[model samples]
Target chain A: MDKVVKVAVDAMGGDYAPAQTVKGALEALEERKDIKIILVGQEKAINAELNGIGYDKDRLAIVHAEDVITNDEAPVMAIRRKKNSSIVVAMNLVKSGEADAFVSAGSTGAVLVGGQLIVGRIKGIDRPPLAPLIPTGNGVSLLIDCGANVDARPSHLVQFAKMGSVYMENVLGIKNPRVAIVNIGAEEEKGNMLVKETFPLLKNCNDINFIGSIEAREIPGGGADVIVCEAFVGNVILKLYEGLGSTLIGKIKAGLMSTTKSKIGALLCKPALKETLKSFDASRYGGAPMLGLNGLVVKSHGNSSSNEIKNSIIQCITFTEQNINDKIRMHLEEE
Target chain B: MDKVVKVAVDAMGGDYAPAQTVKGALEALEERKDIKIILVGQEKAINAELNGIGYDKDRLAIVHAEDVITNDEAPVMAIRRKKNSSIVVAMNLVKSGEADAFVSAGSTGAVLVGGQLIVGRIKGIDRPPLAPLIPTGNGVSLLIDCGANVDARPSHLVQFAKMGSVYMENVLGIKNPRVAIVNIGAEEEKGNMLVKETFPLLKNCNDINFIGSIEAREIPGGGADVIVCEAFVGNVILKLYEGLGSTLIGKIKAGLMSTTKSKIGALLCKPALKETLKSFDASRYGGAPMLGLNGLVVKSHGNSSSNEIKNSIIQCITFTEQNINDKIRMHLEEE
Candidate 1:
């Protein structure tokens, strides 16, 4: 029998919460027999959602938590006060080795805070970056330090490059993944003082394929496999990527709906267009992992659907089996 | 009779210099009878493009500038060493009070450096921000400090809001334009240190309509009239906005071309689709102006066509007529 990768899921987090989260966990069980899910939330609500779903009863379990965190609540304060909160309880499972990984579609602040304070960071890791895979023209590239570090030092960015490279190479299966620092210009000496400071350090590092500076324009062209920057810029890039994507798509749909002839054309082109668009969807890749943690902590989108949650949970199997933490440890602690 | 606006065109700057620059100048002269232009570049090259163009010769004149600045050259060094470079010569015309404004489609770095060093900043101004009008769902909004002032302070940002508001109100005819600081989250308390420190200052300032904070996701939906951020984050947003716009359009076009039926549909829908896409085309808004300068300096896109160049030149007329510098002085030096 294949070894089970236990995933402690935040059952009360995200928009859909108990319904979509419960459905996603069950779908994961149906897709793969080598996993078990411990749903952490209000037991009554979860059981109500899970009553009719047919699955191996022994594989799926629930750990009741009385409190739920809202998007508006302060993450650190909520985590401290609400010990039985789903996010806190779920993170504790990973900390105690009861689960190999933790997944949440909860408040990003709560997860980031809980992942650090509850699950703990690996030794020698200066900062654990929230690295998400953004879809590019050719493929996906990992955007490291998307939200975790602000006012990041050169050392922090250098570490982001290394950790990002390790994730891209092992998880995404990119060989000797090309890494680049996000900057305003392509030249070595260009960019703010932080980039100028980090450029040489990234260039001299022998372990990773450190390409020079990458402008934001080059990012969508799949210019580099691993894109590194401080949290401030990275967060802007990630959000704008989604914003512009939706805006253009909205414009295109309106364009198609403008004339009757184009409406017929839309009918003929819908399937192929959907397939092509799906290739560019970031959710197909799964949630952003909090790299450098002792085990694993993944933050899915707040409004994720069942498919996204299933993909998020499934990605944990690969992360756990590949030993990404061990690889990050080997790469970052080399000094 | 309307007062004549004198604009010194950098005839040697941009992708299609001498040719598109001369043509755009002629087009502007034809469009408005109350404007005169000084074309600065190699005399022979400027004359070659001007020989065939039919326009009022008195309205369009060429001033010979021997040296040319390339995009690859460093801004400060090139501005200093290339004594007779077109950018420098054209800027000198404004400094000498011969021309009201200077417009270029050449190197952005060169244009920014020349705007500060050559034309000089308005007295009492801390920093001159490069503010560009970006196309939005409703109309256009100004993005200040897109490329200038990377290591910006809160005081500089506060000025940017005031200056941006002044430009929007006078030039674009916007009334008390809403200004927002770019941040990771919308909450006042949530942001990088720069944003956190700057938020309350914006809230307290009674001059502009201060909307608390704007996430990158809200930008494309016409979230605010003046989106504020330091240069690093602003630059990323600007480039990423253009980059993602092109990428999605590319995907959608490919989607339409996948099948024969859709190909016919594309042919039928081409005109309406083009019209829809045209509204979101940022090039229609022309170039970014280096605000707070004594004389106007506008930087058009590097790869701009004649139409874009013409628009860039025409925009200077409105900016000069509105006396943007005088208003900037009043707003920023109010305290």
Candidate 2:
């Protein structure tokens, strides 16, 4: 029998806690028999939600955590003080080698802080970036340092490129992903101080297949497999992309349904349009992995649904199976 | 008769130069009687293109500029060495009080440099931001400092907000425009060094209607009338918005044509969808104005069509009539 990949999930995290998290855990187990889940939250709440769902009892376990980290609390303080918090306890499972991965849909700051302080970093990793797979025209591109490490140096961007390349290759199964640094312009001379300093360094690195600078505009057209930037720029690009996508989609839908003639056309084109738009939905790719961490740490959205949670938990299986951390470590050492 | 808004246009600029520029000039003259265009470029090429179009010859004049600035040449060097370049000559017209505004589709760097160096900044104006009107769900929002000033300070951002608010209110007729600083998060303390420093300064400034910090994701939803940020962030947002808009539009069109059912639906809804999407087109809003300059200098896209150029030329009329520059000077002096 193949080894079961155990993923510790924070049941008390996210907006629809325990219920959605518990349901998502049960769904993930049913979908993959080789997956084991350790749901960490208030035992009674988790148990009440899990009672109706029938799943393999052997594969699911509950680790009672007394405290729950609220989104309003400061991240570092919460992580430091709340030792028995669901986020901290779930992270502990990964730190102690009790679980191969940890997934959370909680406060972003807390997840990022806990991932670094608890799971720790792999050797030679300066900063672990939160790399999310953003949907593009052709497929998906990994946007590294989406939120973590707002003040990243040139070397940190280089490491992000390497780690991003490894994740895209091993987990997403893309061969030799094209890596590009995000800049204001395509020219080498263009961009601010950080991009100007990092451009040549990325070009000189033999590890990454560095395609010169890429403008933010080319990002949506699937310009590169891995897009590297400092956290501030990356975060801006990610948020703008998300905001614009939803806004545009909403506008298009409204336009289509406004008139009787268009409404009839909309009904006929609904299936095809839905299929086309689905390709741009980011949640299908699961949560963003905090790359360069010693153990897998994934952060799902705060308002993640059952499907997103399930996808996030199942996503950890590939991280364990492919040994992404070890590959990242090897890549860093080689440089 | 109203005072003719004299505009010096670089006839030798852009991808489809002389022809597009001359045609655009003639079209602008045909559309508005109270506007005179001084086409600055190589006389032979300008006249050759002009001979084919019929317009009020009295309203259009030709100024011979011996040299043209190519996009490849270094901007500062090009401006200095190519003393008689079209961009420099046109800008000189503005400096000499012969023209109310100067419009160009040439090298952005040269235009920006020449605008500041030749036309000069208003007395208290710290920086002249290149503010462009970007399309959004509800309407359009002005994105200040899209490409001009990269290393902007908190004080510079304050000026951008003020100038952007003035432009939106006086030109676009938006009343008491809501100005917002672009940041990574909605919270007061959730940005990099620049945004952090700029946020409170903007909030405290009573000169403009300063709203709280706005995330990039909220930009496309028309969250603010004026989106203020440093040049790098603003440029990224602008380019990304344009790139993603075009990409999604292309994808939607392709999807609509793929299946027979969709094709039928697309045919039926083609007029409505086209009308809806056209409103979001950035070109309708005219060129990006280099705010805070003594004389209005606008940069149209390098690939601008005749329609865009015509719009850009007509746009100068409003600036001349409303006296945006003098209003900006007064606003800055108050602070």
Candidate 3:
């Protein structure tokens, strides 16, 4: 008999919660026979959505949670007070070994907080960073510490580089993922104090493939497989990437719609152009994982729809099956 | 007669050196009558280019400087050894009250070093930051500390906020420009140690309008007029802005040229589309100034052509005529 890769999803989280999350859960089950999903939310709401779609009952189960965590609520306060919230309950399932992985599209703060406080960090793990798969020209690159921990030390960044490389190689199926420190300049001596200190340390590490400094411009070109940085710089790069992509798309759409002649031209080029632009859509990459935790906790976008939710749940299956957390523990133990 | 703005141009610097620099100086002279230009470079090269273009001799003059500083040399070493270099000589003219401003398309490190060591800083200035005008939806916003100093402190960031605010108000015609600390999150408690320490200091300042915090995504939406941060973050933002813009344009061009149908569409939208995209071009914004210096020192792009050089020279006219340095001094003194 094959081992079951069970995932606990916060069905009442995210913008399209319950409907999209439940639909996504059903999609994941249909795609993978070896996977099981525990939908944590109000049982009535989740079951109604599941029944509306006529999902497979044998592969899907609902675990009731009384409350939902709103995006605006303070992370620590929400985790402390809302113990029975969908996010907390889902993480608790993972903690109790009832589920191998936890996925949430709820408030990022709450998700990150719960993943650490409830799911807990692996022993010897100094910091758990949020690593997101960012779309690139070649395929996708993992950007570690994309706004999980802000005030990271040089040591934390060093750990991020190692953990990020391990995840990319073992889970993403990349052979010897190249790690690079994001900096203002390509030269080793050219960044702020944190970068200057971290560069030598990253260069000294022998267990993983360590490339030199990477400028932010080279990121979209697939300059490195695993881009490492403190959360502040990583967050800026991620936000900037999304902002620029959206702004350009908006501009292109506006330009194409402006005049009668342009609109006619747009119609002719719509199919091919859409395909080209779709390659850069971040939603296709699903959620970002908070690495170095005892159990896998993936944080999806708050506005994620059914497709993104479905992709995220499927992503957790792969993460669990690959034993990413165990590898992270071994990597840390080696140090 | 209107007040004449005198701008000292470093014609012996940059990739094109005297040829493009001289042509640019002539173009600026023709466009604005209330402007006098001092072209400092090798006399023969300046004369050769100047002789090719017809302009009023009364508005333009050449100041001889024999030495040249290459980009690869250390900043301080280049500034010290090449005393007669165009950049150094032009900056000296500003220092001696013979010219109102100095402009160079030369090595950025050389210009920054010369701006501080030659032109000197305003009394009470903690550190002079390089501020550039970035194009946005609401026109343009000034991003301070683009490159002048690295490994900046919380105190330096505070001064940058004050100086950037002054420059925007007095020179850029922005009224009470809102100053925002570039951060990973909008909350005060967020960000690295530098931002945490700098946030309160900026808020306490009574002279400028202070906004709490701004994420990088909000920068292009006209979130704040003066975006203040250390060199590391500021440089990343500037580079990413340029990179993303260029990359998008490249992708669009590649897409349009790939097929016959798209080529036809591209031809139809050529004029209007070009006009729209040109507004976002970084080169059109002229040069970035090393702020808080006693005299104006503008650094143009390394690959700057004749038009960019011309625009930078004209930009210096306004920088000098506005007496921006005095305003910065007054703002600091009052605080």
Candidate 4:
């Protein structure tokens, strides 16, 4: 509680840049006393949004960046060229050990590129996976490699399992989280080549509580605490979860308003239904973290709201306090 | 209306086996005048289930098969060893032109193996894709390669697009269905190695209407009529849709029954809510068809009820009447 964790925020990233980013940082400062934020963007835009916001001057600071990177540009080219951009400057802070972490609601490509290229990878890490917490029936599960590396080798998945375990057990405080590989069938032998090759490696893994293959149907019911997959499959699962949840919820709302009697029922059932559905709302969770990097980098959604940005910034406290990167380094080295 | 479409039903397949399978065949005969079902399973079990049931004997015939290929057995080993198995025998009927189609609520792997090894892939077809019509917001979209042909090459995906187009347009009566490759992002460059290579080939193809990439999020919104992907990605999408749909529906029911006030409201809203939810129920859609095969092969869910089995049988008529195979052959040759 005495020690403070400093996080650098990319104020020029995302759809509502500077405004939402600044507001979110201020909100984080108001909520927690053990965290500090450095907002990186153009001085005029950052100061204009922070004009009237009240916060402890000791906990908040601003660092100006001269350039901005758009989502359309090639990520590698942008990251390499935009040396003074918000994302670049913020990441440089982490790389130089001036900041404990870097948070961005920017172009996913740019963040991923900068996280690996600028911040660099840890000694034993092959690929730094972007792990996100998704809401489930019982609770939340960490889905590793949601949008990081694709066409990942079997060895990459073994590392994902080990790294995911470290995050869930240490950061989330789960006691030996059950790690499951995403598969089409329940059987071990029933998967594509990558899964077939990865299954045995995961089974022999002593660092994690490795469960066997989990079918996609079981994921929503909280079948496992840490779900592992290559980026392509993981990306599909993550996006589909959001899409189908909203679609079904929309259909339910329409059904409730279809008739006069049902409308009356909708009124009575609204509160209880809303209370139950609140747990499944994914925005309550923070952004995905690029694990195995030298320093922490969390990528919030491009369309992130102020609340989401606040949550993303606040979660960095736990990620730092628990010394997650140190634990990951030890676990991976042992493996 | 003019010619009888003969369908061979695997009575010993599925969880319920002869009881549900026999009942489904009878139900299909009652619903349509132009379809004939040849029930292939243990003669005694099928006859026992058929006892005291009134049906036209001319429309339904029994072909006894003593062996049943179970879900646990290796698919290739089972299909090759158990020559008299229901899936193998039923597929043989279609292969010999004795039946227009083969429908089974059996092991998916066995059906996929038998469809290729016994019934054979259509000449020039690299791999036969298992395309299922999934319910979407607007109507239904055909998801190609849901389970079969994992680790697919770029060429296999190109054939899937052609075959899916033929099935959706001819059998489902959609004119020039829009084909979309499933990707994480809308942009062409935003996919794994497989999709990146396949995107331009699809764009260049003139036979089918290629609507670039469709993200998994847009899939449930009826974004595209024909969704194409490799088997692994397609299977995850398919299974997750079933999983998330049911989990949310279950949670909604628990919410509706949480309080006494909500219970009274639930009583008033039950009918309208049920009516709306009925359209989203995937059971109304029949089994997945292994497309680009020489003969029609439908792989129904193992847990299929009589209604689902009946729907599976009834769909074969459309496949036969529209001459789907000839259409697929013509389309593939043009490519």
Candidate 1, A1-335: lDDT as tens digits? 65799999999889999898999899988998999999999999999998876888889999999999988999889999999999999999999999999999999999999988999988888889999999988889999999988899999998899899999989989999999999998889789999999999999999999989998988998999999999989999988887777777788778879888777767777777787788778778888999999989999988888888999999999999889999999877777
Model 2 segments more than 4 A misplaced: none
DockQ of each: 0.70, 0.78, 0.51, 0.82
- For model 1, chain A alone compared with the true chain A gives a TM-score of 0.97
Evaluate model 1: give its TM-score.
0.97
The digit string of per-residue lDDT tens for model 1 on B1-335 reads: 77999999998888888788888888888888889999999999998887765789788888998999998999999999998999999999999999999999988888889989999988877888888887666677788889888889998999899999998899989888999999998787799888888888999898889988888888887899999989988889888878877787788788779888777777777877888889888788888999999899999888777888889899988988899998988877777
For model 2 chain A, give the 10-residue run with minimal summed lDDT. A277-286
TM-score of every candidate: 0.97, 0.97, 0.92, 0.97
Best by lDDT: 4
Docking class of 3: medium
Model 4 stretches astray by more than 4 angstroms: none
Off by over 4 Å in 1: none
Pull out the clashing pairs in model 1: none
TM-score of chain B in each prediction: 0.97, 0.98, 0.96, 0.97
- The DockQ value obtained for model 2 is 0.78
lDDT per residue for candidate 4 within B138-244, as digits (tens), equals 78999999999999999899889988988888888899899999998888889999999999999999888999999898999999999999998999998898888
C-alpha lDDT score of every prediction, in listed order? 0.89, 0.90, 0.85, 0.91
Give per-residue lDDT, candidate 4, residue B169: 84
